[model samples]
Target: MSSAVIDLKNCDNCPIRHRAVCARCEPDELEQLEDIKFYRTYDAGQPIMWAGDQMEFVASVVTGIATLSQTMEDGRTQMVGLLLPSDFIGRPGRVRASYDVTAVSEVTICCFRRKPFETMMVTTPHIGQRLLEMTLDELDAAREWMLILGRKTAREKIASLLAIIARREASLHLGKTGDGFAFDLPLTREAMADYLGLTLETVSRQISALKRDGVIALEGKRRVIVPDFDALIDETGDDADGGLLS
Candidate 1:
């Protein structure tokens, strides 16, 4: 991966500033972060970190997508999570990375040196509180993923994945027009197959089926247009309110 630094955007103008780890910071806190922050860019498919590597800094994704994967002794790797824009990249108390992180798209991150960040967290209650909230959010998403992988059909899996990405995009104030939205599918069919425990052909077939049924539309190969967000959610086999229906 290239280690080149990019021109830094001031924290106030950063796209992810409001949702990122520094979201709750006051003016002084932001200034403190600025003192410690730097920007790094990585090309798509480049390794950002390996399992068991020393992590000298913690970061928040400023743009693009990344993935967290773990490799087994047999040399097989399973992607465990996706880091969308504004996602945090490290745990404060952790000295080493537990998963291999890779850029799924060209990515940029705002990083703070670990020692100073940990000290700041001790002095700054907002940072710690926000981190806790984000961790719990991640845990909830993991539970949903377990249900998807264990019980959902192939079609449901694809739809669920799409819905998840679309929801994340919506949170970032992107691609929303009423109840419909659009986003570029970041993962290849092969990658989606691996993550969803389906064959590549099955992944393609299910996407085609979604298009045929008017649940979604496509522009070129990767851009997906959800005509009705609720209609797409119906295909995920999930309750609209995220609870059991009466």
Candidate 2:
């Protein structure tokens, strides 16, 4: 979320280079993708795409975070997913979006026209295969989210959500390890409440509890510093060892 303007010409040095949709492409394929690719930026809190809107393109988040949420006719809203750097923005073959996607922070996205990208997916086995892998990972995360909603205590939910974002931020910036790192909380208390199925008061209280217990440290309202990422992970109620039992 820097104030500097973006230039789209340098795809080779792009920050999310290894994790993006074109991660597996060869030079020739990447050249072709560059020919069709475009970049767009959204300010924090801006709506990127509304639910049921006809999507003109698919995108990969180049930087920053976004939220996928839904709104009812009566105006009730729930946050359903998060889009981090390297996260795919739209589904192939889907012309209309099913959820409202809004920028949670200053954001930039690498975009591909939907029809042409769909055609590329059909012709390029590597692209299709990689996309399938990403899709499966998304499915697994979604199921884990279901478990979080249905089973986790309120404190565990906050810890789990923090761990997820911290891990992604670390991967994007500091490789895969999360220790001795800091990231701004992408969601507001209200948004976290919606995403975690808790009241805003509950979200605030749990976060305060984590801070009190030294699982996390906060600078002002949003910045989170993890002195020991392992400690935070332990609070998430997940297997600390990721134990393999026969």
Candidate 3:
């Protein structure tokens, strides 16, 4: 499919620029990024890269969501990472992808060619430091997910996923206040099941149960509103003080 057409000047408004690769870059470094950066888009359900595929560049999400999933030879798939808006994808110094990256929703990405970016990293301390911080944050998130996959109960898994999405959504739209807030669920039921290591039926059933128990209200299969964030966290087996995963 053809990638989405977007202007590079739009980088000024990019959420990830101030948060990811460009966060601590010097003015000249930022200027260098502008010269090499390009934009690409993917439709929902499209595979951005397959495991073991050679990746030529690294990118950050400009919009929409993506996921990194690994499948065993026997076909058991586990989602290892969830990429939201502004989240970076691909790894520096890695040529082959380690997981399947798929667009969970129609997505746009701001891409920087790996060769030039790597060269700049060596010459620019600020850029390298920012990249290191971003990479470490991703590692921390991945480790947290490992715990979710290996130890959390099915219900806890689902709740943890919801809380995560809700928190991210809240962060994305800062300053919005209310007892309830709505956001689109980027993953399909089948995708959620794969991520949570549950059957599709179990994912569907648990969502229904959450709705029935008043933990969340669903406007449709994709739209979700948490009436109470703390209550939802409670369902995740998290401490009332939000210390469970911490």
Candidate 4:
């Protein structure tokens, strides 16, 4: 864990600038944000926020991955979601965090003081509009996860997770997905199993199966290379365009 510093000098070169909550901000509005923004970095496996904790700021993920999980009364925890680059954390008017946020990899976020951010949201229509769009997208993703967990087969589930990560990585870097695109798997097999509701053995087996089938290649334990993005999408059992056939 580390504290914040004034580091807005690189805002123009920020990788997630076009996709983040500030995407719609005008230059003047961005300068307004810079006044309140600072950076926070967390090491892998660090807890960013615990459920019910007071949230002093809202942020956008600048890099790395994090998980949103909840612990039940019985002490069992479920990983409910992942936050990738450009993902927003905290919400306007929210005084406390709802889930446990943990870093799955080394993470960096650009944070704004909650009070100032909330005030800016009132005067800045673009910020409010973009947040609403992201909220809706989150809702859609939650519904899709319900389908994946409730009905998808083990192989399909693994494929779906891979496709999701690959797509997000591509969007942040290349603006698209295609053959020969490579990305590092941020989660270990055990974590993948926990997130997907499968056994570690099952997670390893499905990954091996995908490799054997030539749907993907592995440069190492964590680096996954897709030979054909379409094939991986096929394995996910999802519509290619994520829409009803038209």
Per-residue lDDT of 5-123 in model 4, one digit per residue for the tens?
63765565343245666676778887787788878888899999999999999888888889988879996667887887778888889999999999999888878899999998899
The residue pairs in collision within model 3 are none
Instruction: Tell me the spans in candidate 4 whose CA falls farther than 4 Å from its real position.
Output: 6-10, 13-19, 175-179
Q: Please, what are the lDDT tens digits per residue for candidate 1 over residues 1-246?
A: 576766554855353356766677887887777778788899998999998999999988888889888778996666778887778898888999999999988988878889999999899988888889888999998889888889999999999999987887687675464455788889998778767777889999999999999999999989999989889889999988767656
By descending lDDT, how would the candidates be arranged? 4, 1, 2, 3
Backbone-clash count (model 4)? 0
Candidate with best lDDT: 4
Taken over the whole model, the C-alpha lDDT of each candidate is 0.84, 0.83, 0.82, 0.85
Q: Could you report the Cα RMSD, in angstroms, for every candidate shown?
A: 2.6, 3.3, 2.4, 2.6
Scored by Cα lDDT, where does model 1 land?
0.84
Give candidate 2 misplaced runs (Cα > 4 Å): 1-8, 13-18, 175-182, 243-246
Give the C-alpha miss distance for residue 1 in model 1, angstroms.
3.2
Tell me the lDDT of model 3 at 202.
92
Q: 123-167, model 2: which lDDT tens digit per residue? A: 777888888887898888888899899999999999999988888
Query: Residue 92 error for model 4, in Å?
Result: 1.2
Q: List clash counts for every candidate, in order.
A: 0, 0, 0, 0
Q: In angstroms, how far off is 182's CA in candidate 3? A: 3.0
Q: Pick by TM-score: which candidate is best?
A: 3
- Is candidate 2 or 3 superior in lDDT? 2
